[model samples]
Target: MSALPDSRYVSLTTFRRSGVAVPTPVWAAPDGGDLVVWTRADSGKVKRLRHTSRVTVAPCDVRGNLQGEAVEAQARLLPPGEWQPALAALARRYGWQWRITYGAGRLVGILRRRERRALIRISPA
Candidate 1:
């Protein structure tokens, strides 16, 4: 694995076609040989990954303050059918915190009549 720290949040940076980097903090958990992250399917990071897998990851706080050295990585958006494993990994790492977040998101989606989740797998580059 890369030197990604075991922090509560990771600063996931993605690039735009113009080469500008956008960073966001997200919860991440190790799954097999990759790090899995949960996000909304329509999130900007997911959209960026579709355009290019190139990315950088660094341990950070929830506010996106980098707390460790950044590492180059490749990110892949997992198909919907493959989301379970990623969710499981997150749940294991976060426990009740994740459950509450998951439940709240599900409830909101049901009320809004649309729910789409994305799973991203980050591998060393």
Candidate 2:
């Protein structure tokens, strides 16, 4: 239904400060004309994105096994005003699995005292 990684998992490659590529598998969903992915605000990807918006994404399996070639894209961390709806869109796409995973994360967050979540918006480069 959307051009943004329709696969169950996508490998998002973000560059480090030294230009090294770091790849991570994540769940992605469509938000308006952008593709959004959720992650903790303190994540390495967030840190890397601060320095450079250039990224690449490819359909992959849950284990990060590539299923297709990657596509170049520009990524930005969305501001607070839109993260909630982006998460809702993710729930719609992933359904119960999303709830389960998010719930588990919430519990972990409670134990770890974390509430900083972020939504990353990606568009064609």
Candidate 3:
């Protein structure tokens, strides 16, 4: 499904156990028939996805202001070994900016001893 927008940022809405929706702005890129997102492994969105794959996404600004209609989708946290394509997609979309951000994040991850980066695959539901 061609649900993903061409915008640089997307607001990913993940649900809580109580069914309240929590939205967070994230960078996303079209990957084949799905969209790939780069995020923190331990982020609340990822945690929520673990319990429920249901989510909604919409084109947004960097500050999370929605610029388009939301589309229902399912999300999955990709395995660590499968992160390369996701990283590549983001890098292609963001260019040098992604490189800088990824580098900084990796350094922080190392210093903090955390598995800082994770990939999320989103498909139209």
Candidate 4:
């Protein structure tokens, strides 16, 4: 497994059923040297992830440009309360408006893990 990223944001790319790339913003956490992300159980992202555990999570600059090797890793949907603090921290940091939507159903803490991927390259600003 590769080292966890050092940035707050990661570009999460999942493969669609049509075999197309679907990228989105995902909050990440370094758990026991592994990368973790939270999403709703019924979310499209989660559904796609279930199909393709292979995914990329990379650090980016303020402009949303890739900064380093988007680490490639496997993703797993974690059950609620598995990682509460991490999930809460992400909500506070991102100011997620849908926190209650997930929290209300007690569907919080659905974490995805990224195992390893090639380092992405980014030019110095």
Quantify all predictions' global Cα lDDT against the true fold: 0.89, 0.87, 0.91, 0.59
TM-score for predicted model 1 compared with the true structure:
0.92
When sorted by lDDT, best at the front, the candidate numbers are 3, 1, 2, 4
Residue-level lDDT for 107 in candidate 3: 98
The whole-model C-alpha lDDT of candidate 4 against the native structure comes to 0.59
Question: Candidate 3 — number of clashing residue pairs?
Answer: 0
Q: How many backbone clashes does candidate 2 have?
A: 0
Task: Compute the lDDT for candidate 1.
Answer: 0.89
Q: Provide the clashing-pair count of each candidate structure.
A: 0, 0, 0, 10
> lDDT per residue, candidate 1, 17-114, as tens digits?
99999999999998887789989889999999999999999999989999889999999988879888989999999999999999998898889899
Among residues 3 or more apart in sequence or in different chains, the pairs in candidate 2 whose N, CA or C atoms overlap within 3 Å are: none
Tens digits of per-residue lDDT for model 2, 1-125 = 22556677899999998999999999998777777898888999999999999999999998999999888889999898877988898998899998998888779878989676778998877
Of 1 and 2, the candidate ranking higher by lDDT = 1
Off by over 4 Å in 4: 61-63, 84-125
Error of 4 at 46 (Å): 0.5
| Candidate 2 lDDT for residue 124 | 78
| For model 1, the run of ten residues with the poorest summed lDDT | 1-10
- RMSD of every candidate to native, in Å, equals 1.4, 2.5, 1.2, 9.1
The candidate maximizing lDDT is 3
Model 3: which residue pairs collide?
A: none
From the highest TM-score down, the ranking of the candidates is 3, 1, 2, 4
Better of 1 and 4 by TM-score: 1
User: Model 4: number of clashes?
Assistant: 10
- Could you estimate the TM-score for every candidate? 0.92, 0.86, 0.94, 0.61
